[model samples]
Target: MAVIANAKVETLPEPWSGAIRSGRHQLITDKPESFGGQDQGLAPYDLICSGLISCTMITLRMYAQHKGIDLGAFQVEADFCTNKEGREWIERRVHFQSPPDEALQHKVLDICSKTPVTKTLLRSLEINTQLV
Candidate 1:
C-alpha cells in the first residue's frame, strides 16, 4: 500500500515529552506527572482513542448527510481498557442529543463499527521502523 499519512516525533528537553508533526498540524505528547513527566499533553494511548472517536463521529456525520438523515448533535466517547488476561481493548459509547428511531440508531451503530480508524484497529497491523 502507498503511504496514506506521515508523522515525525522528536523528543523535547523535558523528559517523556515529544513534539509531533503531521502535515500542517503540530502537537505534543507526554506522559503525566504520575508517570514521571510533566503532564504537557495527551499520552500515546489517549491519542489513539482520540483518533478512533473522531473518525467514528466524522464518518457518521458524512453518512447522515449523504442519506439526508439529521443526526443533530452527537458525542462519541472512548476508553482504553486492559482485561485481566492483559489484552487491551477500547470501549466506545455514542450519545445523540436528538436520538433517532430504533432502525436509524442500529444503522448508525453499524456504520460506527465500520469507520476507517475502527477497521484499522480491528485488523492486525504491521509497523516498520528505521533510524535514519
Candidate 2:
C-alpha cells in the first residue's frame, strides 16, 4: 500500500529532545528540565494526547459537515496520565460555544469517541515496528 502522510523525528543535541517533520509542518519536542532535557517543546506523551485531541476535533468537524449539522464552535482538551506501573489513561473534555440540542450533542459525542485515533488508543492497538 502507498503511504498517506509521512513524518520523521530525530533527536537534537540536547538529551531527550527531538524534532518532528510531517509534510510542511515541523515541531520540536523535549522533556522538561526536571527530566534533564531543556524545556523546549511538548513531551512525547503530550504529543500523543494532542494527536487524539486534534484528530477528534477534525473528525467532528468533518462529520458535522457530512451530516449537515451546525456544530457552531467547539474545543477539545485531553489530559494524559501514566502511573508508576506504566499504565496510561487519558481524559478528554469537550466544550461547545453554544450548546446544541440534546440529540445533536449526543450524536457528536458518539462520533468523537469513535474517531480513528480514539478507537486505536482505547482498543490497545499493536504497532509493528521495523528498522528500514
Candidate 3:
C-alpha cells in the first residue's frame, strides 16, 4: 500500500504536550487542563476528529465545485463517543449556512459517508508501530 500521509510527533517541554510535524506544517497537541495539560492545543481525539471533519469538508467542496453547485458556507462538527459496551465511535454533523434542496441534501449526506477519512475510520485498520 502507498503511504498517503506521514507525521512525526516529539515530546515537548510542557507536560502532556507534543510537537507534531506533517508535510510542511507543524502543530502542537496537548490535553486540556483537566487532563493535566496546559490546554495549549487540541487533544489526541480532537485531532482525529479534525482529520475526519476537514476531509469531509474538502471532499464536499470539491464535489460541489465539479458539479457546478453552490454549497455556500458550511461547517462540520464531530464528537467522539463511547457506548455502554465500551465501543468507541464518532458522531458527525454537517451544517450549511444556506441549506440546500432536499435532493442536494441527500447527495451531500451520501458524499459525507464516502470521504477518505470516513472510509478509513469505518473499515478495519492495522496500525503497526515499531521503534527505530
Candidate 4:
C-alpha cells in the first residue's frame, strides 16, 4: 500500500467572493456566514469531516467489491467534532444511508474502520498543536 504522509494542497480566491483549489483537479468550497465562515472556501470543519468520510467509504467500497458483497450503492454522511484539546482531537461518525442486511452492513462498517486514513486519525495521531 502506498502511504501519503503529507499532501500538499493549494488554494485560490474565486472570481466572486469565494475560494477554490487548483491542481490535477479543481474544487470549490463555500458556506453561509452563519457558520462563522467568511462564507467562502469550504468551511474548514466541513472539509475535514468530508476527508474522514470519503476515505473510509473508498476503503469500504473496495473491500466489499473484492469480497463479491455489493453494498448496493449507498451514501455515507460523516461528521466530526473537535475535542476539548486540539485538531488532533476528533470524533468521527459515519452514517450509511442504505439499510443493508445485517451481515453486509456490519462488514461495511468494519471495513471503514480499517482504512489507512481512519487508522491514522485513530492510531498515529501525535502532533504538536497549540490553540491560541
Q: Write the residue-wise lDDT of candidate 1 on 1-132 in tens digits.
A: 698878889999999999999999999999999999899988999999999999999999999999998899989999999988999999999999988999998998899999999999999998887977
Candidate ordering by lDDT (highest first): 3, 1, 2, 4
Off by over 4 Å in 2: 84-86
- Relative to the true structure, candidate 3 has a C-alpha RMSD (angstroms) of 0.9
Which portions of model 4 miss their true places by more than 4 Å? Answer: 1-22, 29-32, 82-98, 126-132
Write one digit per residue (lDDT tens) for candidate 2, span 31-126.
Answer: 999989898999988988999999999999999889898889889999997799998799899899999899988898899889989988888666
Model 1: lowest-lDDT 10 consecutive positions: 1-10
Which is the better candidate, 2 or 3, if ranked by lDDT? 3
lDDT of 3 by residue, 1-132 (tens): 798999999999999999999999999999999989999988999999999999999999999999999999999999999989999999999999999999999999999999999999999999898988
Candidate 2, pairs of clashing residues: none
Error of 3 at 67 (Å): 0.5
Alpha-carbon lDDT, every model: 0.94, 0.90, 0.96, 0.64
Residues 1-132, candidate 4: write the lDDT tens digits.
564544333444533234444445445566556754456555656777778778877887788778886666666666565556765555655555667778776776677778777777677566675865
Point out the higher-scoring one by TM-score: 1 or 2: 1
What's model 4's overall lDDT? 0.64
